[model samples]
Target: MTKAAGPSRRSERSRVAILRAALELCREQGFGGVTIEKIAARAGVGKPTIYRWWSSKHAVILDAFMEHIATELSFPETGDHLEDLRGWLHSVARVLAESSMGPLIAGVVGAAQYDPALAAEFHQRVYLPTRQTTIARIRRIQDEGRLPDLSPDTLADLITGPIWFRLLVAGDPPGPDYVDTVLAAVASQRFPASAGGEALQ
Candidate 1:
């Protein structure tokens, strides 16, 4: 007789299935239409199975979204901080402009307005970690004397603010050249001396 899968293996498979189902449902029906019942049905798992792992549909969807973007959205270390920043920002623009993730993110942001729990979870789980990573990377670059002497937080905002504005408020897609444009604008600004005692021109 063939041996059955172990409990841990089966549980992991179910978890992957649920996350996949959540993403598919979000793509097909948007976040508003995705429910625990629908996700469980799509994943071929019982409601209790899903509830055992995630608290709500929001938690499931957020996990799916984060898993999907985790690889592509990371900062690349190419030994050139400016180039790395460019690549990272370009990835962000592409993901926001071209993927289902954009709508999902917008939907989550909208829902978070009314759901304090979700907003707090999002801040704690998603926003804070990413922001901390970006700030740390920028601080490292500054320490290398490659970037201007400015608050890393301010620099991070200058880099990401416009892209988010276009996606969330302006309803405009950040196009292929957007990253370069933003970088040029940033590089053009005159700033105080760097750690190497050279001013940004």
Candidate 2:
């Protein structure tokens, strides 16, 4: 006899359904419209099922938002570290500029200002992983003597800060050449050394 799928599979399905529902609702009605009850109804699950997994609507929204950006969060592998970084930044800026998730992200950022718990959760779940991964790659670039002897954290900020400024403060969407321009600016400061062939660590 074939073995049946276990409870873990069911749990996984339920979790995916909940998150998918959350994303759909947030897209249709914005983050403010998402509620545990609505998500449960859309996912055809009980409210208790969502409560079992997440602490609140804010937490659920953050998880759903993380799921939405999962693909974009990976470090690209394009042979050149600066090129890879530029590509990732362009991809992220495009997402923030064109996608519906952009508004959701902005709303979350605003909400996080007043909600310390949400801010903590965002740092823990979203910011830290991406930052650490990018910083690790930057450290590898620094070790190869391509980049300056800057801290990895500082490098990450330098890379992402302008993108966020364009997205939030400047209110101007990054043009296609934005990444190339940024790369040029960084490359201008490149240390004179053999700084290639370094893979992500």
lDDT of 2: 0.77
Model 1 residue 178 CA deviation in Å: 0.6
Model 1 / residue 15 / CA error / Å = 0.6
lDDT tens digits, residue span 104-155, model 1: 7877877888888778878888888888888777777778876667777777
The C-alpha lDDT values of all candidates are: 0.83, 0.77
Worst 10 residues of 1 by lDDT: 192-201
On residues 1-94, what C-alpha lDDT tens digit does candidate 2 reach at each position?
A: 9898899998999999999998888878877777899999999999999999999988888888888787875668977876677678777877
Clashes of each: 0, 0
* Inter-residue clash pairs, candidate 2: none
By TM-score, who's the top model here?
A: 1
